[model samples]
Target: MSALSSSVQAVTALWNRMPFVGRVASQLTVVNIFDCATRLAAQAFLSAIPVLFVIGAFAPQAVRDQLVESLRTVMGLGGATLDQVQGVLTADSGNVKDASGAVGVLVTLASATACSRALQRVCERSWHMRSAGLKVVMWRWVAWLVVLLVALIAQGALHDAFGAGALLGIPVSLVASVMLWWWTQHLLLGGRVRWLPLLPGALITGIAVVALTWGSRLYVPRTLERSVDQFGPLGAVFTLLSWLIVFFACITVGIALGYVVAHEQPFDRWLRTSAATGRTDPADDADLAEESAQRP
Candidate 1:
């Protein structure tokens, strides 16, 4: 009976610690914007190549021709004939699509390369120190890639089945987004901490990510449309900037949230410390530095 009581108390203590962890994560997220942005940009750029290639290869020839024509019109090259545009599109599309099969290989290599870089960036931004080695970093990236692919495929299937506007589809997407965020949290913090112990933080970060994603989908496109309507061509640039900022911000926040939840540290304390000292906690710093020091 005494042992059972102790076990129940231990569980209660852990449960009580979660909210504090979540708050810290949110605070840290706001503080580490630049670090998160650089890593995210690298990941985005690497991922985009494969995505574009897949789109170019799989999309119908007619669609590609239309896209090129639209670009020509946008560029005010009215004299640029459809045949010229079509020829260029055909050549480019072939090159892009022909590489589709290689995308997985490329993505794997790119993620491995980026993981070390990302770890370094995160450590430097959050903490003052760096770590080295690619083994754990590569594994983390691979894990994230697997989870991302699963989420994307599931989301795509849900969209196909119910359409995005359906009531059921909305909840399904929300759940999936949360899962993606949870998996991402797991990937990022898994090295220093056990996955099971970090469940609360992962869950909290996942919920926040889902909320942000849904909110952004509603607001961002409309905001872009309005800006374009008001500012003409220049609005397009602004729209792109807006999207990048929002995306980077959300990613940073999500990461911070996950970290806080897993560590149970106060967000403001870390944020202030990171800024004043220009360094994060030693534990967080160690993994990245270790990964970077590893030989290729």
Candidate 2:
């Protein structure tokens, strides 16, 4: 018992010595980062996937084709894997469009907002901010969906422009991801946090996005194909869900790490100096101090 107590004290002492990293670690524990990522993944899979299929049903043939092309580009889908997805989207599309009227479409879109709301909670928690009311953020939710869908489609074109290879495409994807995530944080937070402080998180998220996108190309296509062959559409569903979990886990970690980095020594000091120069809001310092005080 004495030995165990000594070890615990040593660990505590070590943690105390690294205040910045300790605060970050404490915040992550308080937020249950992995749990949050899993929830986001499940929410997105359940809500966003159905919404995408429904939207595809409503879309014209050309639009549906473009959607498949974008997915293929992003996931490196080919052969049987690509066919399974295209069939899912296009097989009952006409029937779906005919059966679902405007009301159905509206309902599908509203359900998709669950993903937006989940992501907004992540940002709010990372910043230790209160949730914005529905009225304040409802429009932002819909707008975010529109923006995300547009970006998804545009990603194919972005890759094609960069020689359709990972060499150049990686950098393009990283830059695009940074800009998109930066804007996403501001939009989802209802502009409560300024743009500059959000930079570290966005850059971290961008790197993660690029790395995952590149890496997924090597793994997802083969795994997807095998799953489809062995378990049909259901297998594909499971595989995609598993992938989404990993994807969101990395994203959550990146965002949390960004918060930590931005609030730690050199970066925190730099942000404060910038605030003094009128480049950033001095109010952010209070936010940092308050967050630290609340840390376990």
Candidate 3:
């Protein structure tokens, strides 16, 4: 028993001595990142899907076409699989078909804020910050949702900008993704965290998005077709939900990683150094040193 106890202590001591690994392990202990991702994905499926249905049913034809094309380009959808997704989105359920006026659309968009709330929790947990009150962030939720839809709708053009090879498109997409996620973190966090600290996570998310975009373009279409062929429409649902889970997982992990990267060792010093040197914005001063002292 003594020998076993000693061995365990020694191992724990070794792990504790390794700074980088310890920080990562600490972050993981602090946040169940994969679980957060799963919840975000599921929430998006439940909340965002209805909004998509509403948009498909009522949005202008040009907007609808752009949305569909964006989906096609991003997910590499075509043929039966694409048709299945379209059918689901455009389904004439009496409530949705009967839905008219801005009231219904606004309600659907409001429901979609559940996703925003989920994402907000993700950012809060990742950064080890207290939650922002709904009153403070209520409009942010809707605004973020609107921005998200616009970004998605514009995805096809972004991807095809360099003649579909995405040679130049990839870099452009990376920058756009970084900017979007950076703003998203700031917006969702109610600007509690400095932009510089947020940049690492945004960059991580941007790279993840670019990689996943290419991965989906390469892997999703054929796999989706096969799944649909084998299990009917339900297969598409499973496949997409699976994809969403992975996508959200990457995002959650990226945020957590960004936190780890930003706060750990030399990077944290750099942020402090930047602040001291006046390179960062004056607004960053108040919160700049806050995260450094809170490292796990």
Q: Estimate each model's TM-score.
A: 0.54, 0.84, 0.84
For all candidates in order, the CA lDDT equals: 0.50, 0.76, 0.78
Q: Against the correct fold, how does model 2 do in TM-score?
A: 0.84
157: Cα error in model 2, Å: 2.0
lDDT of 2 by residue, 41-91 (tens): 887888865666676677677767777877777766777767766776786
Query: Candidate 2: minimum summed lDDT over ten consecutive residues — where?
Result: 273-282
Give the per-residue lDDT of model 3 (tens digit) for 59-113. 6767777888888988788888667567756666455667645687777887788
Please write out the lDDT profile of model 1 over residues 1-296, one tens digit for every residue: 99999999998798677767555644564345665664555565455445434545656775564454333322222222334445444666556555546766566456544643563345333332343346656576656655554443344344333454545655665566666654554455434433443344446545665565556546655665676688965665565455555555565555555444444446435434233332355556545445433423
Assess candidate 1 and give its TM-score to the true structure. 0.54
Clashes of 3: 0
In candidate 1, how many clashes are counted?
19
Instruction: Report residue 118 deviation for candidate 2 (angstroms).
Output: 0.7
Q: Candidate 1, overall lDDT?
A: 0.50
Runs off by more than 4 Å, candidate 2: 1-6, 91-94, 162-166, 273-296
